[model samples]
Target: MGLIGDYRRLMRAGIALARHDVILPGAYQTRLPLPARIAGRVLRIFGGGARGRPGERLARALEKLGPAYIKLGQFLATRPDVFGAEVTQDLGRLKDKLPPFSMKAARAALAEEFGEADAARLFAELSDPVAAASIAQVHKMSLPEGERAVKILRPGIEHKLMVELSAMKRAARTIEGISAESQRLKPVAFTETIAAAMMRETDLRLEAGGADEMHEISHKSGHFVIPSVDWDRTGRRVLTIDWIDGISLTDPKALDRPGIDRKKLANDITQGFLTHAIEYGVFHADMHEGNLIITPEGKVALVDFGIIGRIGMVERRFLAEILWGFLKRDYLRVAEVHFEAGYVPASQSVGEFAQALRSIGEPVHGKPAEEVSMGRVLLQLFDYTHTFGMSLRPELVLLQKTMVQVEGVARAIDPSHNIWVASEPVVGSWIRRSFGPEGAAKLVAGNVKEITNRLKRLPEVMDRFEASLEPPAPPPPPPRRFAPWWGWFGFVAILVALGIWAAK
Candidate 1:
């Protein structure tokens, strides 16, 4: 009955999606079998068709399906490789905002995280929630003389997500059974990724910690701004953060108001994003217009630390070299990065991949800034990589999506903004610093420190190794084969008696 109910709900949601007016008029009309059409018709009979722009319709359908679906749509929106640009754009506008929890619920959460009495003493004022989302909401508050924003986790979000995600997994499995394309996507794996990210977002403490780490990393980098956390008022379900005042990066006109240099703003946005990506190896995974703001001093202010991506040192260096190669118009070097990073299978010739890359890079090399679209380059590369049996890497896919968004944001501010120009200086400096003489010294120091630590633990390691090598005592013998002679005879007798009784 539980499985049946879940299947029924999922079917109903599918019908709702089919009827959604924004599904490109005939989204499900792809020469499917008569039975499939009949099933779709049955679904339409249960609900009205979608209405609104394609993207807007998607958002609406997802919202109706529930929080888990909305989140799934959001994740897909970040993958331009999966969904086309139009759909991705629509999903990008799908905000996670939902109604805020009640004061009673919020208080309960606070009490659960930090004793109610302690929470009361920590804040001078506990205002109502000012904003809400799928995982949590923000409340305007005061803490000792400073104004702050308090994010409180929505009550029971974890339970809701788990239930819905289980249904989603089941649905994904059913879809895979019906569609071979879905099999290649590894829907189960993708669902797990979504589930893990959702789980992390539900923990307010983790996000608060992420914000603090980002803030500390950027404290000396004047180009970036991450709000400070008020630790005293922070807890498991609640986060207290310093408030930031800035214009939304999406608002170019407002950004231009009062002498905001569009060029400089564009540079700062691009450089700040890459700096985080290459230098710190951590970057804001969600780079929509909403998460970025431009302060009065023209510094870019980043908010919402729920989603971030990490690339190891090797991958970062490889990415830097790829970007450098592309900028230098060295298709061979760019191809080499893909092979070296194991993005391309060694079985494929570097020369052939370089030729494919040249097809993607050549057309855009001398094009005007406005004429060249990074999206095209990315799409071409994605399609080209498939010829060499290079499967998509979700992390890299996320990075590409982010690059698209960041590039779009920068261009909106300055129509002719050259992304390559902004990236060159930052990427060049990072490369030099990473491989320069000083960097070599730092590397040597790190190796020496590691060696010292290992030497200190040498005795303990040897003792453990010796202990592992010592043979264990022999196991007790099996209990005389479980007296199989009698047990088997009795089992066979019962089966024979049952068969005879059935025949009779």
Candidate 2:
């Protein structure tokens, strides 16, 4: 039941999708091939009256499937270019919420992580779970210093997730092998990325470290709030952080509070993400409304740092230039950056790519902020990736996904929120600092230092080169050795004794 087991799990998933009318969805039936159309008609009969758009039905199916599928759906929601806006919007609603494990089970997990006596001593006033999600749940506990939230991993989620993810990987491999067109999407790599992120989410220690790091970044940026980690009470399965006493942005009533600046909050959400990514090269990868808390002071507090997006200096420059180009409506510069970043194949024509970029950017410009959709623009840009022979960048997937989430949350807070406008300050400042005269000076200084360092090592490198050029001395003749006469006599004696025994 190795490969067979994967196929069996996939079969079950297929049936679920068929029941939800996601297999050969009705909207595309007319466009499907004759055989596919016939198959779709037959499948719809077993759909159990699944209603809503295909994405909505698929979301229900994935949610019903469990945590792994839910995570996949969330990942797909980030790719509106592949699925379209309406479908992705429906999928975006796939939340991580799940019923909480029992209080007894929660206590047991804590005791197992920290011995029973220590668990009681630390969490004497531990309350019932305040919130629950697919991978873990949070419980509020009181400490002498302050109230803290204790997050515990689900009892047996790791194994369940591993089984489901293995099936998903098999399915991805099957899809890539069967369909040439799917190769550009990199389904195998995509699934692996999601699987890796899901596995990381199970380890609360990593999450604690992420929280602490982001807290420091937040202090410097003053853009968002991050909870302080309680190191003394934390463990691999348990993360203790200062409990945030605020309303989650997920609540419909969250924005209705007095003193809340909806417009400013929206801008802050957009700008905060850009500032973190462009300036610091790290950001909370999961920026969904559920994970964002609007404190009483109206500051956005990010929690559940199970996923964090990071980029190297090269990617940061690529992102900054792209954003800056878009802000200035210089589609050519944007296209050039893509080429320079090696995202677009060298065989592709730069002018043609620039034209495609223009198509995506010009429409959004001069339009009312509420009328424009950053997600839609990204969708078109992703579409161009295929047209321009650009492959999916695994490293940028999380960053792209988080960008969409940030835009969605920001737009929800204020419909008139203009991300491009918000981005200009951060992106523009970064571009100026990175590509201007000051940047040129730093580049020259760096090159000079590099050359000086190499010059210093020249003598050592030359010595090694000369040493290799010289011939090696011949190996010493095999060590001379001689058996003593007594040794030879003993061998003969042994042979004679053997001969006598044989004669007897």
Q: Whose TM-score is greatest here?
A: 2
Which prediction has the highest lDDT against the true structure?
Answer: 2
Which 10 consecutive positions of candidate 2 have the poorest summed lDDT?
Answer: 494-503
lDDT of 2 by residue, 348-439 (tens): 99999999999888988888988788778877777776688886565475677677778889988888888888888888788889889987
RMSD of each: 9.9, 16.3
Q: Can you tell me which runs of candidate 2 are displaced by over 4 Å?
A: 1-4, 28-38, 81-86, 177-184, 441-504
- Number of backbone collisions per candidate, in order? 4, 0
TM-score, cand. 1: 0.82
Report every candidate's CA lDDT: 0.76, 0.82
Cα-lDDT of candidate 2? 0.82
